[model samples]
Target: MRYSYQIVVPAATYAPWLRDNEFLTLFKQVKKNSLVNFYQAYELWSLVEQLEKVNGDVLEVGVWRGSSSIVMGSKLKQLCSEKHVYACDTFEGVVKSDASRDNFYKGGEHRDTSQAFVAQLVEAAGLTNVTLLKGVFPEETGHCIESRQFSLCHIDVDTYISARQVMDWVWQRLSAGGVIIFNDFGFPMTQGITALVNEYRRDSDKMVIHNLNGNGILVKVKV
Candidate 1:
């Protein structure tokens, strides 16, 4: 039997962006504001486009500089879809980071960002479909969008607890076939996220996809 979850480092060289000028242009524009690398950003872009017909809004729990959020928003705009991207962040840094379940994060990490900074980045991208929610998320600002259904939820919170909370909060609201992508998965520095994603590998209703680009994608397979 195949392993439920494992790492995949592709030996083949495949770069689709070289032939797709549009994605490359987008990567160049958002490179400065995002910590997400090109492979992850490409996946985000492609996934948003793939789910363009899925009925629901989008959610991003960790809006470090709004780069990945912008990627999704831009893709939505290109498709001329009306889906809105709800971007949440503490703007104060990482919270709910427990050292027992986490590595490399204590608290107050990624605090170099502010709501205003992300706002400007969003504006410069000309994304009118993005909304910024400044807080710790789900507990602090999740109620603002309590009634919203999400087609895509991006969890970059890093810590095991923080990532777990965000995942728990979004799971119910996530529509069937919706996806949750963990940003720091597969990285040694973010063993917490890796652990959290691994714990869900046994779930029946979800399909866990391990991306070589350090992303963990969970797709809801059951309605």
Candidate 2:
């Protein structure tokens, strides 16, 4: 049997307009910054637009209050036809990992946003193609997604074990020329994501790592 592999080099596009103007304007208008992170939003949107050009679906592993998901999913709906965006989260906050795993957050530190809240936000945004999968990553979450490939996957689980598990599950499902953006790449707190990326690169020649915003992106290209 022959295994197929491909790598993609992402074209990094900076939208200064979002930073100096649009995002800031929205930040003030909304009266809260809870749903927006300028850098993450801009970079993800750039990746989404590129993926749209090729007709691809989007998947996000961590969604808090549906802010980022709303942004990306809404844009995807506008740019592509019949393209789906899947958002997976426990909705009950991070679950306890095995004690051996590093970077596991002790209980009670993070807030758990309910599924109802996320659903309300998505509905208010009028996002049609967005699907919400409520559960932990790589386990209950895996059942929610079909076997279809994804053009872009955003992993933001924020811990080493969760990040690695999410990547391991999603990497092979990524289409040729798809991109996997790891949100906690070089951040000292999320060393597992960095370690996983390094290990993946050593095992595959077609993937390229682009470090951005304390995050690392693994782009798949056709070899």
Candidate 3:
């Protein structure tokens, strides 16, 4: 009935980001614009590499400062991939946070950003692969991208209802080998996300992976 908390220290000694000069250089510029930690950012950086052969574009539902979008866009640019990154946000903060399902977030918690701010960040990164969609995702902004399919979706809404809505909406649009990474699944304040991710564990059409860096990775198995 309640969520448990624990610190995860990955046993593996591998540190690929340290050796990745390009990633380091790019992350350094976006670090100040992001709330995502170093480990998680590195994970995002690495995950982009896996989508080389997958069809469809990338989708990010919580573009606070455009850091994650830029990171993925930078990778896609490097790979010379034609895939685009649809970065959606309310530009007004979080929404649909239920007090019963969510512990801390009461909506409008991360309003320290604006569309103009993130746009400038994206422009400064020299990333043209990212398209900023400003509105409530899968609601006001969903129709604009309804025709497109997604290879990877990064959900960081930080509430059970919002996360659930995004998963439900993006499910039909996700390619067979597509991946969905839920950000905010490990923190205590984000217990709602943890609860939401667990609700998806027993499904046959997809597989859920719990990562140490607070990401709930969902892989679609059935096309």
Query: Using TM-score as the measure, which candidate wins?
Result: 3
Model 3 agreement with the true structure over 1-223: per-residue lDDT tens digits? 3866677677889887889999999989999888777777888878888877788999999989888889999998998889999999998999998999998999997899999999998888888889999999888999999999989999989889989999999999999999999999778888889988888898999899988888889999997
Clashing residue pairs in candidate 2, if any? 6-221, 7-220, 7-221, 7-222, 8-220, 8-221
The local lDDT score (0 to 100) that residue 23 gets in candidate 1 is 87
RMSD of 1: 3.1
Which consecutive 10 residues in model 1 have the weakest lDDT in total?
Answer: 1-10
Candidate 2 has its poorest 10 consecutive residues by lDDT at 1-10
Model 3: per-residue Cα lDDT at residue 156? 88
Per-residue lDDT of candidate 1, residues 68-169 (tens digit): 999999999999998999999999999988978776889998999999999999998899999999998888899999999999999988788889989889
Give me the runs in candidate 1 sitting further than 4 Å from their true place. Answer: 1-9
**Model 1: what TM-score?**
0.94
Give the better candidate number (1 or 3) by TM-score. Answer: 3
Count clashing residue pairs per candidate.
0, 6, 0
The TM-scores of all predictions, comma-separated, are 0.94, 0.79, 0.97
Task: Give one digit per residue, the lDDT tens place, for model 2 in 84-173.
Answer: 889998876655443444454543333557788889878877788788998877788787676867888888776667777886787678
lDDT of each: 0.89, 0.68, 0.89
Ten-residue region with minimum lDDT total, candidate 3:
1-10
| Rank ordering of all candidates by TM-score, starting from the highest | 3, 1, 2
* Residue 215 error, candidate 2, Å: 2.4
